[model samples]
Target: MSTSIRVIEAVKSVNVQGSPAHWANEQGTRFKNPWTSWREHDWRDMYYILFKHNRLTPKAPENMSTLLPTRKPTWNHEGDDAQKLKATWIGHASFFVELPARANTEGRVPKRGARILFDPIFSTHCAPIKLAGTARITPPACALEELPEVDAVVISHNHYDHLDRPTLTKLAALPRKPHFFAPLGNLAQLMSVGVPQDNCHVLDWWQSRRVEVDIPSQDGSDKTVPAVFDLTCTPNQHGEGRTPMDRMGYPKSLWASWVAREVLPDLSSTSPKTVYFAGDTGYRAVLDEQNEDEGPVCEAFKQIGEKFGPIDLALLPIGAYAPRRFMSTVHCSPKDSALVFKDIKAKRAIAMHWGAFILTTEPIMEPPKKLKEACEEVGIEEGAFICTDIGQTMLYD
Candidate 1:
């Protein structure tokens, strides 16, 4: 046997034991219950449906044009900016947030806010091609080495896209490994990939831990800077998985969205501007459970608004949903995203999870366009939803 084939077999063998049970029991890795239930049809069944409907556009594995590399960004800190926040889209589900420069205000400059990452997928493909049956259409927008510094990383669920092994490996090996956060059962996945325990922080739904971020004052200001900021783990309607067969139970690891805000000294009536990061949620009936438990999604938002006040910026998913019958329950389409925006009462939001990886049946450029039109129809300002190309960064002052 060839040496390369032998190596490939060895790697596959190691992972096989840890593969999800659903795939193990079925012996067919191509189908999943969640995917099937959402579609009301199996993978093969969908193929036939598409063929019959004349929607099959089977193209060769040629490189997709839009999947080109974007240029690195420049961070220019001019004048006295008040703790600026800038976000760079580093491809699918990955972003880099730049904390403002720490300047002395009171007596000392607050520790510049810690950098945080979300459901990061730095690898080329989400799932193994042998399992998913397709490779990623686009490469990651930025390589790990290119990242400035990450202080914390949040794992939304156990999906390969959200919990990529290669990405975790690279992240774990950083000179100063950032604090890793995940749901309950996910520690196993991270350990399996070689991340250490001291660096990991796991949380259940609605749980929060305060992390200190140094508050900066104007460079020449004589004021003493604050000492920290806080990050909270909120809830989301999503699922988790490592293998096809592993039914550790959906939402087992406590799938969640996140809220990050400045920590006020008083912690009294002074409300800090909130930033919500929606991590791949489908609208669930439980969303409204917070109030009288009526309108799930809307109610969830109402509580969030009351607690966090008007959101200054929200990072929400706006793609990967297609063939509505299968995706609506688990993923929100562009229109559904707009509704979520209204529910949350966020001042502005950015559309993500699109144009990075081709994980569904929708065409590449459909998400942003649809979101824009939907926002317009709803009488929202076009600028309310910011959609930029991969690697582009936007500042919310």
Candidate 2:
């Protein structure tokens, strides 16, 4: 196998070592709370400080996934064509996006448009425990064979749930290997899966790439669809790894959100439509920061908005946050999602990260329930925030 590598931006390179690190060691274990020395008022004091105004009512009960009506997985290539955007949720963070094909003259249904998948995790399990722990409550909406032809795959980080080696290996075997885009230090993992070195694009925090797309037009001729998609390595506060022995923690692989923009053929407008894939993130006051002091996270989001202002659609995570003491620092709660919505100023937002995988002790249904209440509290209109179950598809005009 040829071992050629291509460097795209300032992102650092990483080793593909397979040794396990100190993941759950008792002495350095970070799961246990530090309340052993706290007093009575200390508890209330902290509570009021954190959740002073927006108090969460009715603590989530155990077994949350069962609360919501279950929905079966469905897959199809059917869709209406009108230069619109369509998204099919494939459980967890995976999605099938059908971008508009050039106006077909025959009026036949739009043929295959660019099919882009986000954080495509096709593994049977997305947790460290495998058969022992964090088993997936629901299988991936569509198996790899059930998937439509893929043009590109975007991976956010190297977490087990985000980047599954077995899944990627299967995808690499497809007739046409899809283009893989990931943050720094992740190319090694993709190489191990047999993804062609040239097919991989390693990006930094503010870098982008322009891809040429062929959109079949209705006039019997092919239209040169030049979609300038800029895939920057936006910042996220999280860690990565699959096992205790191989804990490739945060800053090692560079967790990030992806911004894909479609610049019109005319040079007058740089980017007409922008879609943000807000990968896993925890709530931080800087998320609401109006200034740059919010650090890498705020700067990255702002840069995306400036380059491609007014995001058309945002796929944001709104689940797996429980035992707030630990998750709050890394994951965003429903209320925090509201804040992110306002911060990014997205036109519409779809919620994910819940009801699919058992990543946390929080009830599976709690995220959406809490999200609904949070939207209500902030007076967000209905349909502004969509929390659909697996196998649901959304159309954006």
The candidate maximizing lDDT is 2
- What stretches of model 1 exceed 4 Å from their correct place? 1-69, 75-82, 102-112, 130-133, 213-227, 248-251, 267-271, 284-299
For 300-331, candidate 2 gives per-residue lDDT tens digits of 34445555558788888888665554455556
Over all chains combined, what TM-score does candidate 2 have?
0.74
Give me the overall lDDT of model 1: 0.61
Candidate 2 Cα deviation (angstroms), residue 373? 1.3
Clashes of each: 21, 8
For candidate 2, the 10 contiguous residues with the lowest summed lDDT are 31-40
TM-score of 1: 0.75
lDDT of 1 by residue, 247-277 (tens): 4333334456777765555633434556788
Which one wins on TM-score? 1
Question: lDDT of each structure?
Answer: 0.61, 0.62
Tell me the TM-score of each prediction against the true structure.
0.75, 0.74
